[model samples]
Target: MRGTPLRGAIYGLLAAAIWGGMYVVSDVVLKVIPPFTLLTIRLILGAVVLLVIRWRTA
Candidate 1:
């Protein structure tokens, strides 16, 4: 029970960090890749991650 809050807080911080860094990373990446190409790559990567998580859980 005591570990639950700490785990949640850690997850929250990680989420925040990724969310914050995304804009900066995207800005730099966009200089090299086209906007649509980047968007497509992000979408594909997100889908693959989600699928892997689901597969592992199942």
Candidate 2:
């Protein structure tokens, strides 16, 4: 597909940034949120994000 490389690079960068920030964010968030509750919230948000991306691509 056209611009596939550019899209891939952008996605890679975004993933990397998220991964890098996750630890810092989680540390502060965990103080306010319980572990399991935080996990569930993350899972739900991730699923919603993936579904939106899939729907947009399709």
TM-score of each: 0.85, 0.71
Q: Which stretches of candidate 2 lie over 4 Å from their true place?
A: 53-58
**How many pairs of residues collide in model 2?**
0
Clashing pairs in 2: none
User: Candidates' lDDT values, in order?
Assistant: 0.95, 0.96
Tens-digit lDDT track of model 2 for 1-58:
5669889999999999999999999999999999999999989999999999999999
Q: Against the correct fold, how does model 1 do in TM-score?
A: 0.85
What CA RMSD would candidate 1 show? 1.8
Model 1, 1-58: lDDT tens digits are 5579889999999999999999999889999999999889989999999999999999
Top candidate by TM-score: 1
User: Could you tell me how far off, in angstroms, the CA of residue 11 lies in candidate 1 after the best superposition?
Assistant: 0.8
Q: lDDT (0-100) at residue 35 of candidate 2?
A: 99
Cα error, residue 6 of model 1, in Å, equals 0.5
